[model samples]
Target: MNFPVQQAQGPDRIGQQTAVEQSRAVAEVQAAIYVARQFPRDVGRSRSAMQAACGSMALADKAFYEFPRAGGKVTGSTIHLAKTLAQTWGNIQYGVSEMRRDDEYRQSEMQAWAWDVEANTRHVLTFVVPHAKFVKGKVEALLDLRDIYENNANNGARRLREAIFAVIPDFFIDEAEELCRETLNKGDGKPIEQRVEGAIKVFQQLGINADRLEQKLGRTRDQWSGADIAQLLITHKSLQRREIAVEEAFPQARITGAEITSKNGGGRKQGPPDDDPWAGQPTK
Candidate 1:
């Protein structure tokens, strides 16, 4: 077996593809075994074994199916050997991918649970009390308050808990109390992007960023004219309705936030005051 081993920066997505092309016949047989026979599930109870088999099968099938007319048995054997080596060397990559996928699936389940909790929380709270919108200024204030509560060593757990309680509405607090409490006890993970990405996944699950929102909001007008303002109002109304539905559906999740309407609020009432649209705009 004369397989070319790729330098391990990460899992060999492109390199594996090249190997597959060079050994198509053997690879097709291996892929057939994987997809048709369910070799991974049947091989062993351990997940590592399943991943190894799956990865090997992928390499094998790609090689066998994409081989040139002249490529022979030696090429097939080489692909098989490379895949076997990858099973050992790329275990961490496989495990991390599997784990992240599993986490996403679990997050979906949690979002459903959060939605149910929100429905109940909103029903109970809306009947008893009314709360105003937390606009941009409020959002900034809350973020600052949260930072203080979270960062302060002298703030103590009780004070921090109180701060969180004050920041969220009673309607939201009822459902999110447990979640916030958990966050207070166990701090959020590092890498802001990961946490935000996880939040976006939940946002996706709730149909917040769905084509539904896009269709309801639609596209903005070409100019910052009255037509654009009307469209903005229409989108704002649509989003307002969604906010209500979201609150009534998922109280635990923080879906409500300030949306950017004007890029420069104080600077300009409308788009460039000049008639020339590209006056200040740059050339490519």
Candidate 2:
């Protein structure tokens, strides 16, 4: 069976794109980016992101193939060896075909080890990575405003707009949150009812079934803390949340929730990746 291979430039051309050329390219982009100070701030972060998007390992077999750009061919063995080479050596040596034939790396135990690492990685991303402290901090700050408005609904209602634009101005998912914030900001402006109702309306527009949000919080939208919205942001892409919206939204896993909780509690940071929904295609 042939596996779908990752598209790679011809191995020969890989040499052409040298460290000097890469550095020059980055310098040029950085020069233009430095024009906006924000770009400079993200320079290191964006580069790391680009690297993560192209990590090691790939499935092998006859059905898979990726064509090279310069009319040069990428042989099947080259593709297979590339996966092992990427993982074992931390880099792909030019003559990978020899390694592919090496029986030492092809043993059943070696394959099992590779898969064990992959499985644990998937487990980690599913249960742990999503609950990042950085995201939680942002959500906490967004909801913290509820405390201020608690003392005086009148002044609290009046100060919402200032809080929104001045404090939590950026959207976590989309503009719906902002719309909800603006609605509360512009209401008869007291007791938070207008803000809550407006948020439900906006969330509905965003395809979130917010009909029960008020009931869940035990207060109409105005009475609920922004923490509810913040929690939504953190777990918006959660398997359970996505499953509620659509059947089979996530791949079925043998791992149980308690298992994930236990395994994740120990701070492992890896797992096998899910299939890319948008493969070799653009997504809006």
lDDT of 2 by residue, 1-284 (tens): 99999978776565645867988978965554445333222324533432332231112111122222233323112223223322332211111011112233221111011211111111011010111112312732222334323322322222322222222113311232333333323333344454455556655654444534543445555456554543332223232322123212211345555445444377543343334465556657
Deviation from native of the Cα of residue 108 in model 2, angstroms = 23
The 10 consecutive residues of candidate 2 with the worst lDDT sum are 122-131
Q: Highest lDDT among the candidates is held by which one?
A: 2
In terms of TM-score, the best-performing candidate is 2
Q: For each candidate, what TM-score against the reference? A: 0.15, 0.20
Instruction: Report the Cα lDDT for residue 132, model 2.
Output: 13
What's the CA error at residue 235 for candidate 2, in Å? 5.5
lDDT of 2: 0.32
- For residue 157, model 1's alpha carbon misses the true position, in angstroms, by 30
